[model samples]
Target chain A: MSMLLLVRKETVSTRYKVVVCRDLGPDVMPLLRGKPELELVVWPEDRACDRRWLLENIHGAAGVIVMLTDKVSGSSLQVVSTMSVGYEHVDVNAVAKRGLKLGYTPDVLTDAVADLSVMLALMAGRNGGIGISVVQKGQWTEYPWAPFGFCGPQLSTTAASPTRKIGFIGFGRIAQATLARLVPFGITHCLYSSNPSSAPSSERDAQLAQKYNLQSVKRVDIDEVARESDVLFILAPGGSGTYHVVNETLLRKMKPTSILVNASRGTLVDSDALAKALREGWIWGAGIDVVEGEPQVSVDHPLVKEPKCVIVPHIASATLETRRDMATRAAQNLIAAILGGQMPAQVDLRGFA
Target chain B: MSMLLLVRKETVSTRYKVVVCRDLGPDVMPLLRGKPELELVVWPEDRACDRRWLLENIHGAAGVIVMLTDKVSGSSLQVVSTMSVGYEHVDVNAVAKRGLKLGYTPDVLTDAVADLSVMLALMAGRNGGIGISVVQKGQWTEYPWAPFGFCGPQLSTTAASPTRKIGFIGFGRIAQATLARLVPFGITHCLYSSNPSSAPSSERDAQLAQKYNLQSVKRVDIDEVARESDVLFILAPGGSGTYHVVNETLLRKMKPTSILVNASRGTLVDSDALAKALREGWIWGAGIDVVEGEPQVSVDHPLVKEPKCVIVPHIASATLETRRDMATRAAQNLIAAILGGQMPAQVDLRGFA
Candidate 1:
């Protein structure tokens, strides 16, 4: 019988296999060690997923745990699991047809993402980025105390009115958490537009609205969401289908004093369009956690150059406690799937299919 | 006719009759047009209460519209109707003895301060200082794509506890506005401590608390106030009696994960002590709008070096809308008092005496 093993020799030895397509924190290593009979092929080079290495090593593997950077396809691996909620990187239909179980970390990260969503919302509302840039660029002394200087939209209970509605571009788990934080700030209405077929359950939406005493929690058109919202939060996934959901046209519909917060993927927004929007006053301001072509952004980046925009380096789920929990959970999900058991948590593929 | 004109001649005669102690922007000057009987002393420098200038222009004036910087002493001038709520700078005992009807701008600044109190509380809880510093410092290179790096306490209601307990160091008008914001945050309790002689009316607190359905609207000892607060807000006036009220002893009594917001005054907190507490984990974090020695803080300031501390340059009443309102109200207060009418708004100092 054939078995899988990391080959120092040309021939494989007898060991059940799990392939880690990317390097995780060291805390995740022991989850594999718990099974003495299984072998783990972990990518030594910590980087964007090495396609060649993954293609070669993922052959005949029982399971593979991957990150967003990795593309898990039929040509690469089966029994795919991801460390994030969105499984856009993995070909879910291929996995289903191959009879491979798909594992992913979901509810475990709701609190962390929720925390960041609120942070970004507040940061955008407070003009924090402009204040920081002013200090960093040595503009503090040049600027004296002026009445209108450094004033951003004040997030308050007083902001709750019929005209100024709270909008969500894609209302998901983290969006709900953000709403919980916003509820206290006196937002009484909500408008959201998600994947047409993958909308939230009526019962769940009803419960959320009732719990917060909101006026309504119904789905609306994208343009309507933008037009009505005083603050539009983009909390959806990033993929080809949903790329650049918030373009210049949608942004122009927002109120002049409105704010935009993007704690999701950078590709969900077009940076150039957003930069133009900020410069031309299409929207009042934005707090962006994820930026297109980020981690490579220079001081002169278009969005960075805009005084009205606040850019954070994709830190939505980066709490110390939450990171450790994600690492541990991702490790457990991989281990459970390889050891003749159901995945600890698996992504539901019905919607994706 | 030897009336003590608190107005300076050289500066006041050139501009308007009232020497606006602090710089009120140009919009205010138009309100005093053609009031030839009244001379306005404008301070070219922001150091409005300069002793040399005050002594030189101390004779023959009807009214004065001063700011927090001016010290209206018996030796200097008699009638001081300041444009700010706090009259600690004015030698009130001397004013009382000299029979000067002191006017102050109190109610005008309540909303601004209260708005900032909540802003500081939210900023402190979210580690806004760290997030702000990180991006401006260009520290996004070393560990990019981090899932859990910068996270702080998020203020929200959960299933475990639907209500937040907001405690006030001083139950004044600003404190009540702060409480109003917390009400929508599912806050059900409001505990406060005020100077025994000037405590807020129990009937007013009860009625306001009942309007919001708060659990209790009771005055508590300082120790209990410190202990019970999830977000302890310091809104008390700055003076010797309330100095360093949140010292190590009180900080020790607070929850480790709790946040402290001081929009009131820097003198209310011990900066060095607060820095130590933040470093040694005595308390979670602090946000200060004012510091002990403000406008003189350098990069090496002790609180500036503390990561958890969010220090703003004393901007509690710094909103555009509020500032304009304050300037207009201050000028009106001076105009009204000088015309032998009641001050537009006055702080009753009888209780303090």
Candidate 2:
């Protein structure tokens, strides 16, 4: 039943020992089991890989398989294969400085993340949570359906408004993929912002605009992206330079008819500012998949309590197919790194250093 | 602020009386007010049109602007204009037998409904409500993010699985619109059922297949739709012939990974059968906007009680822009039918007879 690549022949006499932060599941674990050229040490629990166990096993290893939760550090570590798109949870500079090859699942999860981004935009535009609550909370019978009672801003273009604009904080693979999905919805214009450290892409922008038959797909300043967009997606990565990019000033510029979706990182957005924006109707609504202090959010959390805020736990990339692909890719990365001196998806670490 | 059509100029000796079920808000009411050619008698209550008030005011009316709930059956009524796409609540046969023109709003709400359909599919596929519960209930803290914590089915395809199949119960305008939206999601195959009363379109199917570069877009039967679709959308009309089309037998034939989304009428699906299927994992999940007896749903409702069921009160067409457009269309229909002798988008009721 394994679709995994067959283990290579002509192995070296000595088997290389590798530590896996957690079990890669039945679908992928068989790739490491009984391999003549590899020794696998996987965490034996159903939860996150314990830090102590990782620390103990990371030494004297040729390679390691990890999730975003597992930190990697060892003098003997040759490779660190993480099954997540973002490496913000891991110290990328340190990994590179230690001369370890880093393999991550990026492109494999892009479709899943982009799907969630579009879904979030639609949900937020409709004030979707309120409609869900009316049925879930047994208020449906208490109150009757009225004309224009639950109406929120429409996401699609109608005859009255034939052109719709969408913006992105980061114009990367996921953002472009999300834009591609919005084309059939009759999106006419696009605005996006890239990190100031990165160069502009007018040529690529022209190509994308022409491809989608959009009015314009321009690289603009963050202020313009915030102000002009009817729906804004924050797909930027997290770090100090981009931290709290969607703060008070940025929130103020967003239209009251617009929707905000954060499918990328938590720290890139300011929670309090967004909460205030929603409270004051600065924006129509927000669909948040990641919170600033996520996995620690409370029922009383400001964003959680906002009726218009449709918050999902950090599950943007959590799909059975995507997770399986990620795990399989991670396993393959580990196998390739240890046995063949190469990784299928080796993350370029030179830039981080 | 008025996009309402201008009143016609004709110096008539007498004005025709028209009764409106609900007050069309500021943007629309001006068109009806101060009209020398018409007298308006509207229900003053903010609730569903009071039946007694409507009946009392319906006598001798030239035309009536009614909501879906306000049924019309008056001897002197010449025209009935309802601001809803579905006229199932109104007796079309009776209206046609009485020789009254029926004007209803359609086409304008197509994009809004299609947008909701896609949203529901994504929500259902991701088990979207559970993720919301995890965050909204503050269980996020207790249950830390796991490798597969909230994993459900992925709506999009990846390299490993390039082709995805989508099914629709009805292949009408909204269904085609919904399919157009799914094109970018990498949906490779489409299966739909037009009413058996309608003719098959092999030519249209070929054209659609060529346009979308799909594997196949075939018109199939209900059994095939149930068995083959990874995500099945119920967008059919409501009537006895199609009632409970997705009953126990149809549900039992569906894939365990499939999602059922009902953005159309609820009666088309059997709630008990669907709940049972979900309970036994015969189908993955369901996203329902309309219930058999909606606006009467409670927490105790079988479908609502299902953990995988993402229910929204019947709001598939609820969008601020769409609602306004419908109201304006309805007003235009009433004005044209009474003053200018032509409704903008009149529904032909001859077929009902």
Candidate 3:
């Protein structure tokens, strides 16, 4: 037959596909539905997806929705718009090399994380961990009121401030939210030390300081951040760039009555160093949200065993309203990116230092 | 005269004789030693002296130091002065009728009480009680993550107006102290309900409010008091007249997110009603220093069982420094009153309603 006489075969339009590695709960499904053109394959398995399974099922995928348990590799990043702020699980270099857009839910969870930061601060500051243990172990009855019994360092906005100052290791979004919460509890000044290279503009710093009516808000050197703070918050980003920022040297520089709160990354802190600091009274107490190797940490962990340390499982962004908003926004971001429109909310991949 | 001198000479030369019902601990005894001439007779038991035993041994007492447990009755007002702020055990009306100068430690312990009030408020508002319970019960590991888990309210200062509403059930010295502590916490408006007859002049209120930069400080009716408070502190004096002032009707008027803190007296609140309110969410949470029938409260108590209610055994004035100060001041007050000079710090035994 002649070439012009032959009829061209019908070509099917390729749909944008996503692999939800593990099944999302009932609340998350409606958000992904009603987009007739997108294809979503739910694994329906509650366990972590095997590497082979993820690679096989992720063919021609432009999106990969994942929970904290998923291990997304370079091979799986054929196309993926992640649904989380911490994209450590996903192969970032691969995504960059493939020229694929990445999406993450960040600012939406700041308020919830901030709320939790304050919560841990209060709990640890008040000696709540030990106090409740006393109650549970039926010890309160035996030791009703021994003078100087069971009292922890109060987060005195006034008493602690005259000599002990408030400082932060990383002055980021959650740290700012925590400062906002602490202002009502009587914090007048805040000194912070972010990475020197990540230093924000003076105008933005001034705005933040004025916004909170802080006496002074400035980025200082790491040593100054330690020496001045009565309540030092560890809220830096994770990864090799900022690991072990609050080690023994920085901890030893703090006041004996100071409290340290970490609602940020796990690897950013040295737990063994923190334990020694707490035991030796280098710092009065510490409230840690992320341990060195969380999810594998046991009751016998040194940080958990330390009486002065308050260890909360990583739950800074776990409020009901906030989580829902995060999931919904994340889904929206993926859909918008695939639909050839602007994301309602998008994470700045370039901003991760 | 030397042939037949049989008159018994009273030990009037020992002007500094003191009888303490209980042993003042290491922190307090040093303050007492400041007055070297003063002789202190502590009870051997070091707990509490029986009323009859005290009456017999209190013959030559220049100062009678009593604890919350001792009952110094109308019959036992032979001492020159009684020492303590809460003289309910001392029978202060009888002391005045018997012409014994009554002294009390008031302003000295204001800061401690105020610090405790804010502490209780923060603890209750942040759900420290519940969180502590969870961590102690080993529930933290059992249920690691959930959407609506461990969420509590937060207090943040707004930039436009840096203030949160702070209300007191009664406006007294302790109430004023509590208010002072709250000022640094961004409290701008203070509402209170005092005894209608003992209400201070508007000018006095205005002056005090201006000193603290509070926008409005006024004595309001109980209904209005309950309706507008973000934190309603029960700091009123306790007696039959003020019993159950914060009952169901008043609690219902409070906001659903409001926090109730009682470092004042147990009788000021209706415990049964408070338990019901907490369970029903009439108010968000409560922190109680004094329970209705405290020291007798068991784990099965209704308020104790309620997740939102944090019951602290009355330790508002329990700081090491403050307690020592109080004890020393109490001793001074008793000594000053006994010597017939003007009592340094005397509580006017007027209508205590």
Error of 2 at B121 (Å): 0.3
Model 1 docking tier (incorrect/acceptable/medium/high):
incorrect
Each candidate's DockQ score against the native complex? Answer: 0.19, 0.71, 0.14
Write down the lDDT of every candidate, Cα atoms only.
Answer: 0.71, 0.88, 0.69
- Order the candidates by DockQ, highest first: 2, 1, 3
TM-score of 3: 0.77
Candidate 1's residue-wise lDDT over A72-107, tens digit each?
A: 554434467787877776777777766677888877
> What residue pairs clash in candidate 2, if any at all?
none
- Reference-based TM-score of each model: 0.78, 0.95, 0.77
Interface RMSD, one decimal, each candidate: 4.4, 1.2, 5.0
| Deviation in Å, model 3, residue B151 alpha carbon | 2.6
Candidate 2 fraction of reference contacts recovered: 0.74
lDDT-better candidate, 1 vs 2: 2
**Model 3 chain B: ten consecutive residues of lowest lDDT:** B74-83
- Tens digits of per-residue lDDT for model 3 on B120-199? 78667766676555543445555344433455554433333345688898888888877865664457788988888884
Q: Give the TM-score, chain B only, in order for the candidates.
A: 0.87, 0.94, 0.84
Off by over 4 Å in 2: A1-12, B1-12
Ranking by lDDT: 2, 1, 3
Q: Over the stretch B4-49, how does candidate 1's per-residue lDDT look in tens digits? A: 8697544434322455555667777666544554667766664435
